[model samples]
Each structure stands twice: as C-alpha cells, then as structure tokens.
Target: MAGIVIVGAGECGTRAAFAARDAGYDGAILLIAGEAGLPYDRTKLTKPIVPGEAPFGGLSALRKPICHANQLDAAGITLLAGTPVGKVNSDARQVTLTDGRVFGYDRLLLAVGATARRLACRGGDRALGFRTIDHAQTVFAKARGKVVIAGAGLIGLELAAVLSGQGAEVTLVEAEALPLSRTVPAGLAERLMARHQAEGVRLLCGSEIEKVTPGFVTLSNGKRLPAPSLIAAIGVVPNTTLGAMAGAMIDNGICVDAQMRTSVPGIYAAGDCANVTLPNGQRVRSETWRCAMAQGIVAGQVMAGQTASYDDPNWLWSDQYDLTVQVVGQVADRPDALRQLPEAELQFSIDSDGALIGVAGIGRAAAMTKDIILAQRLIRAGAKVTARALSDPAIDLKSLLRTQGDV
Candidate 1:
C-alpha cells in the first residue's frame, strides 16, 4: 500500500518518516531526497572551524547522519536519494519524479527547503552561495585565500568565523548598521561585533555592494576589496514550486496550519519551506534546525491519525570562535531587562504584564547554554518574572521558576 510519501529528504522529511512510525503508523513510507548521499546535519556545515587540516575534513567530519541504513530499516522507511520530483499532483494524491517514476500516497509532506538568496548587484553572480554540502565544498576549497562575504546575518557571521579561524583574510559586509539585528539583541550584537573585529574579521556594516568580479569586490563608496573568493549568505527563498503547482496556498511560504496541514487536505509542509499560520492570521517563520525537527513531528503525528500542533517558542544557537550565542522567547535584540554575569550576559524581553517573553545570552559556551535553557522553560510557562528579580544575580531563576509551580 502507498501509505505516506515525503518529498525533499532534509532533516524535516527524514525526521517525519521516523516520527510517523513512532506515532504507530504501520504502513509503507517513501522519502525522496533531492541530493544524493546520506542526509547529514546541515547545521554542522559552517560551525567550529578546524584549523589547517589535511585533505579537508572539517565539513565531512561533522556529517552526523540524519538517518542511517539501520535506522531506516528498523523504522521501515524507504529512502530514495538523489531523486528530483517532477510534479506533485495533489488532486490524484501522487508524486511524479522527473525520471517519470510515479508514486501515489495517502498523505504527502513537502519539505522542499529554501535555496540561498543570491545577490542582485552587478556581477553578483560571481559570488558563491553557502547552502548545501556541495555549496560549502566550493567555499571551503578557496577559504585559504582572501575572502569577501556579503551579509552579516547568522549565516554570513558563522561563515566568517569559520573562514577567519582558518587564517583567511575575511571581510564581512552587511547592509544593516549592526550584525544580527533581527535575531540578536542590540547589546549582544555589540559584543559579537567587537569579538569579530578582535579576531581579524573586517566587519563593514551599513555597507552596500556595487559589483563583484571574479577576484574583486567594489563597494558603493568605490572601495575595492580583494576577493580571491566571495560568498553570499544573505538569506534564503522558499522552494515552493512543487507545492504551488500542486495548488497549495502560498504566502511568505507554503502556508501550514498549527498541525502542519496545508490548505489542501491530505497535503502538508514543514521545515524552511513552511510558514505556520496561527489562529490570529499571523504566520511564524521558523527556519532553524530545531524548528524543523519540531514541525516534522507535528506534521507526522497529525498525518498518522494522531493529534498534534506546533506552538512552541522558537530558539536557535550560533557558535563562533569559542563563543556561543543563544536566543529564545522574544527574539527582539532590544530587551526590556539585562543581567550581567562573569561568564555570560543575559538580555531579557518582558511583556507589559511583567512576564518574561524572551532572553538572549552570549559568553562561555557552557554558561550561555545552561542559562538559555532555563530561560526558555520560564518563558514557555509564561513566568511573570520581574526585571528586578532577573537583574539580581542573587535571585536564582530556578527558584523563581519553582514559585511559578514548574519544575
């Protein structure tokens, strides 16, 4: 029986395959992969730069299998690697491969992830994109020389950190005045900016690119920078061709309800290609690794005749030169409160009712991670924490959480 079919076997697709089994769906599952080779964790692509290694294993070394043969076999998931889907016929509940292979499904999950947004400036095509493993291979091959990177967002900054650690002369240019303005709080951005500069990263915020040649970049101000290798980590555009062709509603992305069901019945989407629509008509754009996993679980469980919905707070972490930054709850960089610790600094976003909505922390990896997790739990429980209490290092957050009746 053609039980369930999942397109685009990234983390979301692969996880959903297993999640269906965990949800007790005893049926056939087909997972179509766009890229060949085993599905690996995409988050490890630009993290923890390895200094001067032989034959280049920095990326491959971090290839944690999303689903191995043993796991797939045990979970009873059929994985078709390197398959390009030609068309998704929702009316017929079928997915057709470019090679003309047809597979029908009781339910379909489209996790066709996003592609790197390219630069629109003149000669911008010269810059390489950093997305999949193939994209990283090209960038990593030339990272030993002078490199120019556009955009100071998370992707750009992380790439800069990795390349700079490898002794490359790196320049990071962003259109915004500050890096990570949207995801990171202002205070953390300042600290991160300083760290990047100290580590020999030429960060040029509030900058624009005029043109990019094969080996050089010209800024709007006529500053020509040497670029033996150039990369664009600007952002991503949702890959919604198949979903749209299948007649699903598309807004900022393929619109999915709380349970990850698309507007079309028996169809759903998750991961980077999905925008979770709320009851109030707002869409939540969650594109991180954890977010993908969460959405996959929701989609799979709901598809397997179980009830589930994705309403969790979004959280993500970034690693750069021994410093790890994590944010949860209210993502606004401008926080309503601040807490300064020796090992880490916490920025808090509190609601008007005095409930802690968000928190951003940066410092030592160990300290930052612990505090962030605690803050996430508190925020999830809608803890009405005050600035005064959060400000005092003496007042333990765990104690405060206990008062709210959460373990």
Candidate 2:
C-alpha cells in the first residue's frame, strides 16, 4: 500500500510505527530491523545480575520487543528483521534489501542510529565495545577478574559501577582531565567524582595508555595494570551511510529541519542519526534516548500529514551506584540562577531576553526529576524567574510555570 516505511527498529523507529498509527496513518507500516529477535531496551544492560542467573536476563530488551507481539500484530505493522539493507533508492522511493527484495513507500524515515566509536590505539582491537545486545551479553556474562575500560564517559562510569558492585576490579582510562568534562558542569562533575572514588573506583583521568598486551595494560607513564578483560565505552558515531547515499545533506549527521524532514523530498531522518537545524542554521544532533523517541514521534506525525516539530529541550540522565544525574537543555559553565534544594543542587541558565535556556542537576531522582521537568516547562514558556525565587524551597516551581506568560 506504499505506506510509511521506517528503517531501523530501535526505540526511535519502533515508536514511529505506533505514532503513525495513532496519528491516523492507516497505510501499511514497514519496520526494518538489522538485528534478529525482538528489539531490546539497551538500558537494561547496565543492571547487575544475580549469580547463576542467565546472561539473557540482562538482555531483556533483546528478548522482548519494545511492544508485545500482540500489540504489533494489532497495529498491523510489518516487521522485517535481521535483513541488511543494500541501498536506499531515493529516486525510486524504494528500499532494497541485500537479499534482492524491494519495498516501495509513500514516505520513508531513516532511524538507522549510531554505532560505538572505536579506539585508535595500537591494542584497541583487544577491547570489546559496549553497544549492542550481543556486546552486553559477552561483557556481563562473565564480568569477573580485572577489566580495563577506556573512556570515563557515562557508559564507562556505569559499567564500572556495575562491575565493581559485582566484585570485579575495574580501572577506567580517560584522556580528559576530568570525567564527563564535555557535558557535565564542574560542580556536578566533582560530586560524581567523589562518589565514584568513595565507592572504590580508581580514577586515572588525564592519562593515556601506551599499549595493551594480553591481560595487561601499560600506561604512557610506564605504570602497568592487570586487565584480564577490556571494554571500550568511548562514544558512538552516527550511522550515516544510507542517508548520505540518498543525497541527504550531512554535517555531524543527516541534516533535517525541526519537522524531521531531510533536504530530499519524501525522505526524513530522526533519532541519533538526525541532526536538527536550528533557526540560526546551527546543526545539533542529540544522542539521548528521549531525544530519539521525541524525534521519532515528530517524524511519524509529520509524515502522516499532522503538524508537529521537535521543540522539546534536550534531556538525559545517568545512574551510577546510588547517584542519579540529569541534565536538561544546554547547561553552561556560568548560570544566571542557582538553587540548592534539600536533595539537589540546580544551575539555571537564562538568555539575554530573560528566558530560561538550560538547567542541570545531580541528586536523588525523586527530588530532582519533577523540578527538572518543571524547568523544561519554564524554558518552553519563556518564563522569567529570580535567583531568590529559585533558591527558596517554599516557592513551588510549578508556581513559576503557571505565573509566567509566554514572552
């Protein structure tokens, strides 16, 4: 029926199928997946499993689809799993599989997502990446012994927490002077660093590895550490081959408008692989799970002839040990207002026009999530707030949200 055809079966693509149905897209929806079995929730991989429990238990996402089989069946979305797409034939408005099958589409969405970026060092090959379900299975299945993880990013820290809790000696290697230097504020970063150290995690920030041998890693400083296992949590690169082949403008990722529309007609990109062009023409690509799901919904609705845009502020959170870190919008080094709550410390950024621009906080999830969400509403409403007001616990944040008229 040449309905909406979505490529990639991650959260972004899977959600798009449902969003299309909800948006009144009754046409045939085809979701193509590169991995076999049900599409899994990658978040489950970080959880520590009990002894003697099947490794697959940690891979519940791999075993269970985003939606139950019955739900997918009821939606009538055709799922083509475990097939490699040979090419995205834009001119023909078709997708060709490696097995020589073709499917035409009235509209096409590219949610191909990103892959784990590799280490460029000499012994980087000895390290296994932490991205897919198989990678998670291979890693946590036998997470004993000493493991050396490269990169002190969110992924690395989370893995270290899990392994340390499971009784594995872990050493984290990072080239940066501080962990999460790129995204996290110095104040919040310090708090997390102290927590990691308190939990007995060895920090080797501002260091590099000269080389890695079997069961050992030699540092550039000439120190050697036992590394019976190696993991790479460096980062991820956008999977942009298909979109680039289809002639979509590429910057850091496949460029798309706020509506998730690519330069090419009948083609759109979303999720981690989609770079959104702001009104100022700046290209911003978000790698957060929420951003992916939001972009997917926008693409689905827009493709279904509904009105929508990806206007939500970028938000993401990470859990390590007993700590939970959350950031919304774009947090800067210096903030316009700062607030210290009983359970969380928040930094708020306001624009020259007195509109809320960003917010960052680290604390107990119960105390901070609602406020972070409230701050996002403030940002959206262009609400004006005072540092004194933000500092007071008696003043409910929702008060500001309700009082602020859209500027």
Candidate 3:
C-alpha cells in the first residue's frame, strides 16, 4: 500500500501520524524519527534538569510516553526510529534513507523541525546547544561553576533560571539592547531582566562573544568572563535541507499554505520547519510546541482528504522563576502602539484605530491565566478596548466583551 510518510518523528511528526489515523485514513502510516529514543516532550527537558522539587517529574520518568512506540503500533503506524532520510525524490514520491532503504509515499509530511543556532568563536565546541534531551543532559551534568549563555532569548533565559536555581553562576550575553527585545515589548523584557537579576543571574546586554578559550570568554565590549561551561541559545534554523533538495520552496523556512501544503505536489510541511502564509500574505513560522502540535493536526487532517487550515494567532508561554509569561499575536512590530495596563504585568498593542492586535501578560500563573485567555479572545475578535477598561482589574473581561457586543 502506498503509505503516508512523515519525516522527523518529533512532536509534529508523531502528532501528524496520530491525527491521520484519527481522521480515518486507513492507508499505511510511517513515522520516521531521526533521533534514537522514543518521542518525548522536548520542552520538559530544561525544567527537569535542574533537579529540584516540582509538581512534575522528568518527561521520560512519567509512566506514559509522549508518543509511545506501542501506541503507534496499535494505531498501525510503522515507526522507523534512529533512521535518517538521506534524500527525497519528489517526482517519484520516494525517500532514500541513510541505510539504503527506500520508501514510497502517496503523501508526505515534512516536519523535520529545527536545530539550535551556534555561536561562531574559538573553542566554540566547548559550548553546548540545548535542543535535544542529550544536550540538556550534557549541560546539566556540567552546569556547575561559572556558565555563560550566549543569548537572552526564551531558551537562554529559561536555562539561565534553571542553572541559577541549581547554584550555577549564570551569565547571559545578548546582542540586543534588552532581553527578548525582538519578541516582547521593552517593559516586559525589563521585568524579565529584573526577575533574572533577582535570581542572581548576570545580564550582559548589547554584547557579543568575541573569542572563547578553554577556560574563559572575551566579549566584544572588552570584558573577559569565566566560562567553565557555555551554552548558545541564540535561535534556531529550520531543517529545510531535505525539503529544499526535493525542490520545495524555501524562505525563512519551508514555505507552506494555510493547509500546510508545500510547493511540491503531494508534500506538506508543518511545525518549526514550515513557514505558513497568513491571510494577509505574511509568512510566519512558530517554534513553540503548541504550534507544532496544532500545525501537525491540521496538516494530518488535510492529508487525509479532510479540509483544514491553520489560522490561529501565534501564542507562546515561558515559565521562569515563578512567573508565567504569555504572549499572543505580534509584540515587537508595534512598540509605539503598545499600552501598559494599570497592572504592571499586563500590556496590549493596538492597531491605528485602537483595535486590539496583541496581548502579553507576565505574573503568577494563577493570576494571569484568565486574563491571558480573555486577552486572546479580544485580540482574535479585534475588539476595540479602552485603556481604562483594560487597566482596571475590577472590569471583568467578559463584561467588557459583552459591553462591546462581542460576546
């Protein structure tokens, strides 16, 4: 039988396989994993490595696998783990594996995900990139003593928090003026920097790593810092080599439509590997786990001959030092348009007409979850909200929506 082949058995690939089955596609389903182990939650790796008291154990320590091999088998999925696809014959609809095995597919889903971007410097090999469980384990083992991180992005900040919690002298280096300046507004970034500082993390903004030695690092600002261990969490580059080799269109990532259909016929792309075109003709790629899962399901459903489109606003969250930071829609693009609510932790961005376009919240998770949900609704509906109403904690969000007849 011509099978539905999924490449890169991370969250996106595994979820796509399951979604295809759930959508009632009976054809053979093949899930290929480049990594050796069974699929597990990559997001859970950072928190558990700290080895402190928490409500949850490590991802693998849980009884249930993130995507169990047995469960995939039960769903009639042929899982090829530890196997890497060497090439893609787009015209023939066949994939050549590194081990010389070939598989033909009626439809293909390329969810190859991404790899962490590394810093270019001498002794750079001494620095680790945290994208996989193995990398997390290696970093965790060597987290003692002074550890310098190369970026102050989400991953870098989270790792800094985790390592600092474990008694490591953590220093974060960033080229941007503020932490997460490109992702969140300056106010929220300032709060995050404050939180990190409160946790004893050293922040080095507007700096770059000029050179690295076995025991130390030199900054572009003429500062030398101890670096027994270094980690680079600058960003990620989408794994688009296979798709590109297959003649798929590539921009920032593999280009796909709302249906996740790639440029090549019978091929689709999702997760971090896919840059989806929005309604306004803007192409964006989300690296969050939620985005991967959502895009995978939509792609799977579309591949199964069901109509589906991924149109949800980009949403992501970060947990750091008792703060749950949530951001939805675009934040950085409208810096001047952003308005801080009376609640110091809440902020919103509006269009020219004052219609809500984005929302960001940072505070205790318990206090911010409901507000975040409401803010998401307002942003989705493009509701025009007054600053007074948004800032007033007493003004119920649902009531505000009802008052605007948005309910």
Candidate 4:
C-alpha cells in the first residue's frame, strides 16, 4: 500500500511526521534522513552543546535528539537513517534512494532543508562551514588555534563567543561596515560590538579578503592575516536540488502557497526549504528553529488533510557573548522610522504602516515579550496600534489581550 513519505529528517521532516501521526494518519509513514543518529537541534551545532566547556559534547551525545523519532515510531512511522534520496520521480509518485531502493508514496513532503554555505577561495579544504555536529566537533578540536571567521554574522559571532571563552584568539572579518549589518541596525550592531569586544573578540569590519592561503588569509588591504584555522559562516542556501529535479518551482527556495503546498500536486514543502508569506504580505524563508518546526507541523497537518495555514509572527533568537537577542516579525523596508524604547534595556521597534512590523530585544526577556505582545496586538487588530499606546507605562504584557478585548 502507498504510504506518506518525507525527505530530510531534520527539524521540519521530523516535526511533520510526528504531527501527521498525531492527526491520526493510520497509514504507513516513511521518513528519509541523510544523516546518522536521530534528529537533534541544529542551532546547537555552532554553540557549545553543554554550554560551559570547550570541545563540548556533540549533538549525537545529546540524550533527547530523537524524541520525535520515538513518538513517530510508536505511531508506526518508518524512519530510514543514513539513506538519502537520489532522485524523485514525481510523476510516478516514487523516490529513488542512493542504494537503488525505490519507494512509492501516496503523498510526499519536501523538508530536505539546507546546508552551510562553503567558502569561495583556493584554500577551500581549510575553510569550514557550520551545519552538523561533525562540523562542530572538527572545529572544537582546533578551538585553541588562532581562528579567523569569514563572516561576522550570527553563526560566526556565536562561535567567536564559544572559542574566546575557551581561550582562543578570534578575529572576525566582514565585508560590510558592521557586524550583522545586513539584518540588524547600526545601533544594535554597535551594542553587539561592545559586547564582543568586552569578551576579547576582534572585529575587522568593512574588510575584504583577497584570497585564503595555507595558514593565512590575505586581506584586500594587502595584509596577510595568519591563522591556524578558518571558518565560513557566510550564509546558507536552500536544499532545493531534489525539489528542482522533481520539477517543483524554485526561486532560491521551494515556492509554496499559504497552505505550504508546493507547486506540484501531492507535495508540500516547508522550513528552510520553502518560501512562506507573512500576514503583512511579505515573502520570506526563515532558517530559524522556530520557523522550521512551526512550518513543518503546518505542512504535515495540511498534507494529512487537516487543512491549516502557516502564518505566525516570525521570531528568531541568537546567543552571542552571554547576551540573548530576540527578534520578532519581518523588518519593514523603511529605515528612518525605527524607534527605541530606552537605553537601559536595549529595545527597538520598527513598524509598517503605523503597525508594529519588527521588534528586537537584547539583554532582557521582558523586552522581547513587550515587542511580541505589541506585534500580536497589531496583528489581532488588523490595523496599527498607536505609538502612544505602545509607550504607555501602564500597559501590562501578561494582560495585553485586554487591549484587543478578552481572549
């Protein structure tokens, strides 16, 4: 009998499989994961897993990575580990594995996810990208060496914290004017700069590298920075090879509708592999753990015939230099209208059409909650909330729903 098949056993694949079973899909559920061991949290790959030591335990060493798999197995889901799909004959509703095994399915879900982007240089062998546990382990082994990271983004910054804590001299190189300048405002970047500088991380902003040589990366300014190891946390590209091969519409990622349905019939895509539309009419592909699991469950339920959509306030968090940064909603196209609450807590809010569209919180969890509640209120009202209302001191976060009427 034909069964439900899911590719890529990352967060998305695992979440979808479990959600499907929870929705009472009694048929056979087949999951294909390319990696060994059960699915664990990918965010922990760059950070120290145990949180206080260098060369810390790996993700495979985690005891709770496979809880979703256990739940799915109990629900009769067939999980295929160490086996990756080589081809997808979508017309025949079948998938060909690397080992020449073929499986037919009634419905297929593509949550194949993405891998870390590799460096573009001659000494590519020495350049590393953070993605899986093995990559972290390889990096942790050389934590004591002088390390130069290619990008000053979240992954690089996080790794800088871990390495610097363990007594490694870290230098971060960014082509942009500031660290994480693409996504974060200059003010926030300055705050991060202060935090990392205090933690003994060197930042080389607005700098370009001419080439990466053996044990050294030549800067564009003709300075050859010597380092024992190099890491590339530049970015990640979606795993759309299989989806494109199957004739699915691809534009940086698998294009999906509001319901997480792919272009092809009987197929759905979600997580980092799919482009999702927000309530504010923006299309984005979130690589965060929250988006992956949320969209995965949405895709799973929709594929199981429960019929739900994947539209929630976008949220992501990054841990760097002992600071917990929380960001919610998509930032608008405007820059001049961004506002901040105060200096002590470090909170920023950017609105679209007078409605709160983006919010960022640093140092305090309460700051994040305020922004979340503000965004939630704006979304619930389907209109803009007055800036005065947001800045009011009497506004209670836990009772925010009262602003929109009783829950």
Candidate 5:
C-alpha cells in the first residue's frame, strides 16, 4: 500500500505518525529514522543523565524511547530504524534509502530535524559537539577535569550547569556581549549569567576562541584556559538536504505554510526541518520540542483532510542549576513597551497595542510555573493588560483576565 511515509523518526516524525492514526487514517504508516533505536526525547539530552533513577533514568528517562515496540505495533506503525533516506523524489512520490531500498508514498512528511554546528578554530575537532545522547554520554564519561564550552547559548549554558553540578570546572565562551543576547531580555540574561557565576561557571562573554589545542583553549582576548574537555554548543543547522534535493523551497529551513505543507503539494515538513510563516509573513523555524510537536500534529491532521493550523506562540524552557527559566513569545525584537516585576523576578513585554507579547522568568519553580502559564495565556490571547497589573505580584493574573472578561 502506498502509505504516509515520514522521514526522520524523531519527536516530529513519530508524533506525526501517531497523530495521523489518531485522526482515523488507518492505511499503512511508515516511520523512517536514521537512528537505530526508537524515538526518544531529544530535549532530555542536556539534562543530567542519572542511571537507575525513576522517570529520569532507565526506560523512563527522557533519553529512553518514547515509542516502544508494542506501542508501534498496536498503532499499526511500521518503523524502519537505523536507515537514512538518501534522497526524496517528490514527483514520483518515492523515497530512496541509503541502503538501496525504495518506498513509495501517497503523502510524505519531512521531519529530518537538525545537527549541531561546529566551530572552525584550530584543534576544534578536539571539542565535541553536544547534540545527541551519545554526545552527552561521551561528555559525562570524560568530564573529570576542567571543561571549556564554546558559545553561551542555551545548550552551552545548560551543559555548563550540568557539568559544574557534577564537580567539573566549566568555562563558557561567547562572542556576544551577553549570553542568550538574541533570545532573552538583557535583565533576565544578566540574572542567568549571575546564577552561573555564583555556581562557579566561568563566563567569557564578548570573547572568541582564538585556537583550541589538545590541552588548552586560547581566547581572542588573550586569555589561555585549561581544557581537559572542550565542547561546542554553538548552534544547529537544519537538515534540509533531502527536502531541498526534492525541490521543496528551502530558506532558513524547509519552508512550509500554516498547514505545514511544503512547496511540493504532496509533501509536508515539520519540526526543526520546517520553517513556518507567521501571521506577519515572517518565516521562522522553532527548534523547541513543543513547537515541533505542535507542527507535527497539525501537519498530520491536515494530511488526514482535517482542518488544523499551527499558530501557537513560541515557547521554550531551560533548567539551569536551581533555576527554571521559561521564555514565551517574541522577546528578541524590542517590544513597544517593557515592564519588570522585580519582586516576582519576571519581565513582561508589551506590544504597541498594550498586549502582553512576551514573558521571561527565572525563579522558584512553582512560582515561575504559575507565572509562565498565565503569561502564555495572556500572550496567546493578545490580552490588552495594564503594566501595573502585570508588575504587581499581589494581583492575580486570573483576576485580571476575569475583570477584562478574557477568561
């Protein structure tokens, strides 16, 4: 049977298969993956890998397979693991695997995801790129001494926090003046930087890696640091080769519409491999798990002839040391206005129409959790709220919503 063929059996691909089944499409569903094992949560690779711990370890760990064999069988999902697709023939609706196998598809979903970007400095190969579970394991096994990390983005900072927690001295290098300069507000970034410094993670902002040697890394700022282990969490490049080769439009990622439909009609793209157009005609790709899952589900629903569109605001969270940092919506672009809730350790970005457009918080887990949920609601609804109400911890967000009849 010519079935729905999905490439890249990560969160997006697996979820798309399940979503298609759940939406009542019972035809043959083929899930293809380059990795050997079942689909696991890629987000958990940065977390502390604790062996034998429940939920976070063993089969229940985020690193463990999210989709088991029995589950796949029960769902009637056929999985081809450890097999990479070499090219996609959009016109013929066929996929060619690296091992010379070919599969025809009525509809195709490209969820190939992304790979970590590597640095080009001398001896850069000595530094490992932290993206996969294997990379995490290798770093954990070799993290006995001082470790230097390139880039001060989420991955770099997260690894720093995890390694430092395990008693390894960590140093983070970033060419930007502040860590997460493009994602979080300056105030929140400052707080995070302070938290890392307090926990003994050295920050080398506005510094570049001049050269990397077997035993050390020299900074452009003329500082030489000991580096028993060097890691690069620079960024990621979307895996758009197959889609591009198949004649799908490619920009920052595989360009897709709100329905996750690619330039090619029978083809769709989701997850990290898909770049979605926003309400303002802006094309962007969200590499977060939440965005990927949403896109995949929507793509599946659309493929099943159901009405669906992915319009959720961008959301992502990071657990660094004792702090749980959550950011939602577009805070990178300067908002029309900004408000700070110092007591609550929160910042809200207001658009020109006085709508809550973004929120960033770093504090006690429970409090931040509550604030994040409320912030998401307000941002999603585009609620026009006063800065005073948002800045006051005494005022409950629910009450404000009720007062405005937005609930």
Candidate 6:
C-alpha cells in the first residue's frame, strides 16, 4: 500500500519510477503512459523523428537499445504503456483506466505532460502542433516542398531548421517582432533570425495568416504562399484535466508548491504540467527535459518519505544546426531589465537589487561557468551577474573565485 503510482510515462514519470527504485523503495511502482512505444526525448523529435531523414530510418528515433523505458525497466519499474488514466478518484484512492481497470495507490505523482496549443485563427484545425512522436512522424511523411509554419516559438524555429536544412523551402511566420520574444531578448532573437535566413529559411516577423486553403496559405499582408504542410508552434497547455476531474487545484498548469505537493494530500505534480514557483520568486512551468527529470526525482524522493525540497535552478537548451543555446535560472521578469553583453555573446537578467537572476549565452564558454551559475542559484545565493564582470578581458577567473565566500 506504500507503493507510488505515476501517470504519463514521459521523462517525468519514468524518472520518478527509476528514482523510486534507486532510492531503495522496494514497493510496487506503476507507470501509466499513453504513448504505446518507449519514452524518447521529445525535444529531439523536431530534429530526428521526421520521416525520410537519415536519423529516422529505423526505430532509432526511440534510441534503440538504451531507450528511456528500457532504462527504467532495468531499475525494476513496471511500465504500463498505451494505457491512459481515464479518471482519478483521489478521495477513494483509486485510478480508473480507459479499459475499466482500477488501481489503488498510497502516493501518486502527476506527470501527465502537456499538449501543443492550437491557434484560434481560421482553418486552424487543419494545422498540426508537434507534441507526440506520432504527430512528428505523420507531419514529416506528409511534408514535401515548401512548408509554411506559423509562430516563431522554439518548436516552430527548431522544426523550420530541420525541414529547411533537409532541402524544404520553409517560411516561418511570427506575430511577434522577434523570434522567442517571451524567452530571449531581441538581440538573441535577431541572431537566431539571421541564422535561419542564412540557411535559406524565410522569416516573416509581425505577420499573420489570414486564411488557409488546401495546398496554400493566405497571409495578412495579402501574400499567398503555397505549401502542403503547416505546423503551428504557438504554445502548450498542461494536461491537467484529469487532475481537475479529481478536484485538484489547476492554474495554467497544476499548481504546486516548492515541495511539488499538490493541494490534496498524498497527491503530487511535477514536470511541464505542474506550475511551480522557485525560491527566487519566479513562477514557470518549464517544458525542459532536465527540469522534468529533476522534478521527478524530487517528487519520487518525497513520495518515498524523504524530507528533501525541490529547489532546482532551471535550465533549458535548443539545438538547431550547429548552434547549442543554453539558458540558466529565471531571466528578469521585466523586459527592460535584461542587458546584452559585449560582442552579442551573452545576456544577463538582473533583479531590482541588481543581483543577477539569470544568464543566457550564445557562443560556447567553459562548462564550469554554466555549472557555477546553476550551483550558486540552487543554493539561493546572489546570481553575481554583471556585464562588466563577465566582459573584462584582463580579469583572471582564479582571482574572481577567491573573492567569493564559501558557496
């Protein structure tokens, strides 16, 4: 009866199951996932899961041999794939599956993940947002020449790079003036725009799709483009309906506290579907793989009667072409507070106190720099983010390290 049940066998649920076993919780751990096959990295879908690509030739999209689910199974976790939870009766301590089976659990973890958000424009239903493996495969199979993608979000830009790099004429339309405006500043967005343009991908900022017809799309500027495929990377909505059905508090995502504990006792939520506020006063439902895994570990540890708190310095990365962009901690909530570093190399998000809240870098730097940023923030210390400090050419890093008190 002390067993833990995890819903949604993505990175979050799988990590919780593995972590539970690794932590010596020798009880029945059940992972219920809607996806039929093994859990693969969803971020890699835009890059490798597209059909007809060299990487998508075989079952390699699932990372054959050393797969996500396989690794979980190796840790003695029971996985129930292709079976989704239909309803949760938290009061009665039971979960009903779509097939009319009920399972009881002492502790439950909600890692249901999220679904891609759809635009409310005309003919929007005809568009597809990449959220699952099947969707990516279907989109890639149907994609041929000239694809019109709406939205300049991470998913849209990543897919544009993949399709365009593979010889498809890609036209990416964004309503915002810059790409990734909500996440990155204008300078980073402009640089990303330049990279996409250099690779022959058409960028349309401050543009909207007026209408969509078969094999063609009409733009707001009275321009009609021909394309057989359309991808809408607008945003994502958390999979919180099940939690709501069970009478759990729901916000943009399932609202949780610093401990990943839901409003209801014995029930917890984590991953992209759970909206959590960090110690630094930043609230975000991060969709990054690392956040999901780390949250899962924390949830699992808590479910197994551990007192540890989930205080992760959130980080995310996107791999497009040869560029690897890494973001650490929460950027300044205010747009104007973000300052760009010299050579357009890095950007710092400073709080009202002028303490660094986050750091985002464009070019490669020492891996330790990223680790230090995360480690310091995880301990709730000053971010130490300064433009002159990072840009000084003559400053020795060793001396700078000596100045800081024990981290």
TM-score of every candidate: 0.95, 0.94, 0.92, 0.90, 0.93, 0.88
Using TM-score as the yardstick, the better of models 2 and 4 is: 2
Question: In model 1, where do residues sit more than 4 Å from their true spots?
Answer: 48-61
True lDDT of residue 35, candidate 4 = 83
Clashes of 6: 0
Residue pairs whose backbone atoms clash in candidate 3 = none
Q: lDDT per residue, candidate 2, 166-257, as tens digits? A: 66777899889889988888788888888888877888998887787888788878898988888888989998999988899998899999
Candidate 3 ranges with C-alpha deviation above 4 Å: 49-64, 332-344, 401-407
Q: Which ten residues in a row have the lowest lDDT in candidate 4?
A: 55-64
- Consecutive 10-residue window with the lowest summed lDDT within model 3: 55-64
Best by TM-score: 1
Report how far off residue 378 is in candidate 5 (Å): 1.9
Q: What is the alpha-carbon lDDT for the whole of candidate 1?
A: 0.86
Pitting candidate 2 against candidate 6, the one with the higher lDDT is 2
**What would the per-residue lDDT of candidate 1 be over residues 1-407, giving only the tens digit for each residue?**
57999998888988898899999999899999989977778998886446546334443225567878998999899889887898999888899998899999999999888999999999999899988888877777666668899999888998888877767788998999999888888878989999999999999989988998778999988999998889998989998898899899998889988889888989999999999986657688777888899898888898899999887778888988888888886657567778888888888889889888888889987876766788888987888988889888888888888999844
**Tens-digit per-residue lDDT, 1-407, candidate 4:** 57789998888888898888887788888889898778778877765545455543322222237456557667888888898899998999999999999999888999999878877766655787688877877777665668898889888898888788777789999989888776665667788888998988899988866788888999879899987788888888999988888888998899887788888998888999898765557788888888899898988788788978877767778877657776666553233233344422323354556655565656655445555565555554544455555555455444444555654
Worst 10 residues of 1 by lDDT: 52-61
How many steric clashes between backbone atoms does each model show?
A: 2, 2, 0, 0, 0, 0
Which sections of candidate 6 miss by over 4 Å? 49-70, 279-281, 332-344, 364-380, 383-386, 393-402
**lDDT winner:** 1
Provide the lowest-lDDT 10-residue window in model 6: 57-66
lDDT of 1 at 80: 91
TM-score of 6: 0.88
Q: How do the residues 1-407 of candidate 6 rate in per-residue lDDT, one tens digit apiece?
A: 43788998777887787777777787889888887867667866776643455333332232322156456667767778898899999888888899998889998899999988886777877887788877877777766577889998888988888878678888999998888888765666778889999999999999988888887788899898886888888888899988797777998899888778888888899999999866656677888888898998888888877765777767777767766566677664333233233333555566666565566656444433544354345325664445565455344434444455565
Clash pairs (backbone) in predicted model 4: none
**Could you give candidate 5's per-residue lDDT for residues 1-407 as a string of tens digits?**
68899998888898999999999897899999998888888888887555653222322113768789999999999999998999898888999999999999999999999999888888888888887877877777676568899999998998888777766788999999999997888877888999999999999999989898888999997789998889998989999999888899999999999999999988999999899996579776988888988898998888877899888888888889778778888775344434344433677788778888888777766667777788788887778988888877778888766665645
**Better structure of 3 and 6 per lDDT:** 3
